[model samples]
Target: MSYFHKLIEIGKENAFVYEYMAVMDSENRKYYLERALELSRNTKIRPKDYKRCSYIAFQSFAWREYDIALEYANFAYDAKPTNDIINLLGCIYHHNEDYDKALSLFHEVNANYEGLNPYVLCNISSCYKKKNSNKMAIRYLEKALDVDKNNKLVYYSIGLIHAATGNKKLAIENFEKSLEIDNNYEEARNALNSIKE
Candidate 1:
């Protein structure tokens, strides 16, 4: 790939080329962005490279391009395979709606990499919820709460699941708690409103 090589040669001189890429503009931008990140990686080693790729993956995720997010996340994981990268890959898998794959990645992070962090547990809860294993989902969500009581997101998610399971009182309580923590939480507010009937 001469384009990548050219980028490698140009280095920081052209580093700014990847600042922004509109979603509809070009599919080829993925390669260029990956390469630029790789060029940054070459400075140190796989760790730096993986971080750069992960940053790109996050940007793609924010753009709702799960494919692109997965592509870059895979690169980062292959580069270092750390617990952080594994969990990030798990997040990409989650957003792509491959709950099983997301769960597996999260499990790897939990069992093989980091201890069960609040965020990892929250993601596990999500995967389980997607699979309709409400018991397991609630279990993990509760565990996440134990790990981080201040996480408004955890409360919001638990509210959603509880509402779905017809635990109206518990759902309302969780939604209220979520809103109490972060008053601007639109999803929780909406859920609270819908359930108030």
Candidate 2:
């Protein structure tokens, strides 16, 4: 950590140093991330370091720091709008309750990508679910299953929609399928238990 701080002191414009410091310092992570983002933007180091921004965006999203995630994701998208970056930005939008925008971006990925991507399909399903379009949600999840029949999350997601729509039988069956695929899936196990109760 001190090494990183020393590097920063010597080369204050080094966005990578600030990003590294962000990874090393949990307590001051947001501050370090912000500084890295600021410097990276001003220094126009994006061509060489956009992936670092993408990584930070994902980390921020995982930590539920949606604003930080959005900032980094937008920057990364502007620098290089790869499919993964677009999907990450869509996820951020979904979490922020901007379901329409998220859906648009997810569909864009689905249409442009060559092969089937179950995760992207699941994300689309989630946006539909949020919009109270359970039927559409189920449709997308079914597509996900078509791509990967044994995908635990797809089964679990189907179970959730069924459970929400008061179709306990289908919900239980899907949850069971999820557990069959991955018995260690705690979410499926808990959902099954709750359904039974």
Candidate 3:
């Protein structure tokens, strides 16, 4: 098949996988994402498409395959150092408990896309929290909240930072706020209960 034809096939597979993902059908999402990866990996196709590699990495992450996700994320980052790919690398590092690496990537991403993405700020906040930098974590979490006041992730992170700083009341307040936005947020619930206990 021609390169254009191969690209078309990859695009179709990505569309199908994304559609399934939108509906939270993890099994179907994985099936179509795997198909997408196979199509993208065909000998006739170029392997330099960072977007496809990023999608594959995301699929691996969704399936909890952290190592594979990290590999693909690194590939995507090397191919194109866009904010999205960089953020994915940061997430992979964070998931693997490589907080220092994750923190560096998050800072790089923040410098490139600062004030433009609450999610990136949230990721930075998480890395700071993991590193036991409670003040810095709170700073970034607040920045995330300023970007998106209704972001439950920011609230949760703020709760964690406050808890780590031994501010149980503030932690409970932020966790409650997180639960208000997402009642099923088990992390917030667990943190709140732990602090209470």
State which candidate has the highest lDDT: 2
Note the residue pairs that clash in candidate 2. none
123-152: candidate 3 lDDT, tens digit per residue: 888888788777887888788888889988
Q: Least accurate stretch of 10 residues (summed lDDT) in model 3?
A: 14-23
For candidate 2, the lDDT comes to 0.89
Per-residue accuracy of model 1 over 3-78 as CA lDDT, tens digit each: 5346547763343345233223357666656545554445434566676677777777876767767777777777
Tens digit per residue, CA lDDT, model 2, 129-160: 99999999999999999999999999999999
Pairs of colliding residues, candidate 1 = none
Rank candidates by TM-score, best first. Answer: 2, 1, 3
- For residue 87, give model 3's deviation from the true position in Å: 0.6
RMSD of each: 5.3, 1.7, 6.6
**Best TM-score among the predictions, by candidate number:** 2
lDDT, residue 20, model 3: 40
Off by over 4 Å in 1: 1-48, 112-116
Which ranges in model 3 have alpha carbons more than 4 Å from their true place? 1-48, 183-186
The reply for model 2, stretches above 4 Å from the true place, is: none
TM-score of 2: 0.92
